[model samples]
Target: MELLKTLPAKEVIYSFSTLNPPVLHIRPGDTVAIETYDCFKNQIQSADQEVAAIDWNEINPATGPIFIEGAEYGDLLKVTIDELEIGTQGVMVTGPELGVMGHRLEQMESKIIPIKDGKAIFNERLHLPLNPMIGVIGVAPEGKPVSCGTPGPHGGNMDTKLITKGATLYFPVFTEGALFALGDFHAAMGDGEVSVSGIEVPGRATVTFDVIKGKHSKFPILQNSDGFAMLVSAMTLDEAVKTAVEETIDLLLPYTDMSVSEITMLMSAAGETQISQVVDPLVTVRFFVPQHVLDSLDIQLFS
Candidate 1:
């Protein structure tokens, strides 16, 4: 196992496109323990901090473009999240131009929430359990740089709450060594990220990386105790849903004898459509097929 420490300027990459040299290099099957910054770069530490004073460009800093030995384009990179530990407090902010209800808001707002004994203390009367998650994670794209704030074929800012501890994420390898990076820790968030932000905070994450030669995933795929989910992002919710369903069908085809119609039927009955976030430049949707459903069909995501 190797340790990759957080250095706000160097190791923390702001965009997936402007690929820099890897801060650290590790081979497949190696474990790496890394630290990540909050979406605000820890600039707003107190609730009373001015939300309008933030620099948007400096938000969502990711931990690395860590190079993995032997990981090449057209291959798949499997990352198993061993742990995601967050800080005692997190900041959630929103502006008139953000979120589903952004158009109705009058001005910018911010909140500093403290986590105590596993719950986010929203106020004196309301608290919710902590569900720490990774909000931004991806490999460097093949062409022009994509901001850490958007999501696409090359995953970035796909604020899916399911990306928690004990989940395995599979990303398509577009560039050599994958050039992977991650950040934007959320102490807790709901589907759709309806408010345009979650309990954003800085944290440490431990993960293991491995190479899956030859096979590639067009979008990110997640595997957890409950089932398998394909993370798809697009320009609109309808398009994102369509892409996620299509890709999931393609993935399920090789393992089942079910015809297209039969597969669609099965999916309609056993699969679920989940909204990741609708706030980014691209919308994200997740298509999930339960573990029991796959088990019944004797299907496996990777052989």
Candidate 2:
């Protein structure tokens, strides 16, 4: 019912949010455009900005401190990435490094993806479809040194495409300001984010925003506009799967008249869990809980 403070930017800052509030006192279904840039942070001015060659210091700059009016500690920011755009016409990939799953970042060598006639041309050989995503999206770690490649439950660098437009992410607020910062926006990526990188492109984004107070979850919960609710993570492959399953059990228990034992029994049938990556060190696991079930459950009470 309240319109809150909004921010739009193009680079990184120390603490994006100063208050770390729980909810961004706002209504659902509201849409807004978010600006972003290439992950190189402009530090690597040329395509020579090779992998393992990047300074890491001058990469992945996030924009803004969109202060959520009533957000407080312990609440979840349910952000829906409504739209993603490569505001400009540029795409680059440096050398490929080791393969996460099968995509290397070192030997990959950076090449320019030229946009001609409104389409991105790949390698002058093959055309890669564009699917932009924020490589790094998260709230303030308070004083932690969260990097550009690591995504945690706080929603740092999950690197998954599911966080794209229409995917609602529930991130926990650690600091008072929640200090949300999002950057390293990629033009496109795959399952394990296995490519150490994707069609790295520059662009701005638009997101629908809202917040929930009371309780929270252990990982980013995504409700696709498609009628499915999924839990995401960046934990070790095995750990990520375990956590997702655990989260499912909890999500299911409350709605069913079933006891813990009964809930556990239904887990193998009522829904499904699967590993999105087995190579990214930080894996991506998704627990698909039907939207019908999620619709009946209370997001705030889960916290």
Candidate 3:
């Protein structure tokens, strides 16, 4: 096992660019206990606070550029999330120009909610069940640097709620050591995150890493207890969904005995797709096909 704690304002990567110096190194099958800050860098404190008051440059700060031993370009780095401990409070904001509902707003609005009894206290009259999730996570991109605010093949700020505990995220290793980093905790968020933000909060995530030899896929894949999902981000929801389904088909082909036409038929008949987020620079769509469906065909996702 290894350990890596974030040094607020330091030991963080705001963008996935060329590899950063490794703050911690570990071999495959090793476990890491890491700390992360909220998307706003844990700076905003109250509902009355203005969105413009926050520093945009320091927005979504991920914990590290962790170097995984033996991870190389074109390989697959498997990150199994073991645990996520969210903070007691969170913040959600909506700016006039910032979300799906932004056009409906006349002024910037923000809310600070308290979490207790497993609920997000939105106000004295309203509260909702807590569904904590990680908002940003990924490895370095192969090309030019990408801001933490954007998401692409390298997986930054996808804002996908499926990235909870007990999920395994497989990312392509474009740079040596993988240079993995993650942050932007959310106490809860809806499917599209239409409001432009989740219940942003600080949290800690414990994960285990493993490198799959020469098993790179076109985009990141997420496997949870329910099923296997292909995560793809694009400029539009339609494009994202298309790419996700296509990649999922590609991944399923080699594992099953079905031909391309048969796979396509099965996906059209049984596959489900959901929105990961619509607020980032790129929208993410997840195409999910149940494990049971694959099991009926004797398909193995990892193989």
Off by over 4 Å in 1: 1-10
- For model 2, the superposed segments whose C-alpha errors exceed 4 Å read 1-9, 14-32, 42-55, 88-97, 101-108, 115-119, 228-235, 261-266, 274-281, 292-303
Encode model 2's per-residue lDDT on 1-303: one tens digit a residue.
644334455435423334433323334445556566677664444556554566767666666545555566788877877777674445555343444433433255556666555455776776667666676677765455555455566666666666677676777776554556677676656766554566666666777666688867667777675444445665566667777777767765665577877766656666777554443446667877665545554433344
lDDT of 3 by residue, 50-103 (tens): 778778788888888889999999999999999989999999888787888778
TM-score of predicted structure 1: 0.96
Candidate 2's TM-score reads 0.77
Candidate 3 or 1, higher lDDT: 1
Residue 275 error, candidate 1, Å: 0.5
| Alpha-carbon lDDT, every model | 0.89, 0.61, 0.87
Candidate 2 accuracy as lDDT: 0.61
* Pick by TM-score: 2 or 3, better one: 3
**TM-score of each prediction:** 0.96, 0.77, 0.95
Clashing pairs in 1: none
Model 3 alpha-carbon miss at residue 273, Å: 1.4
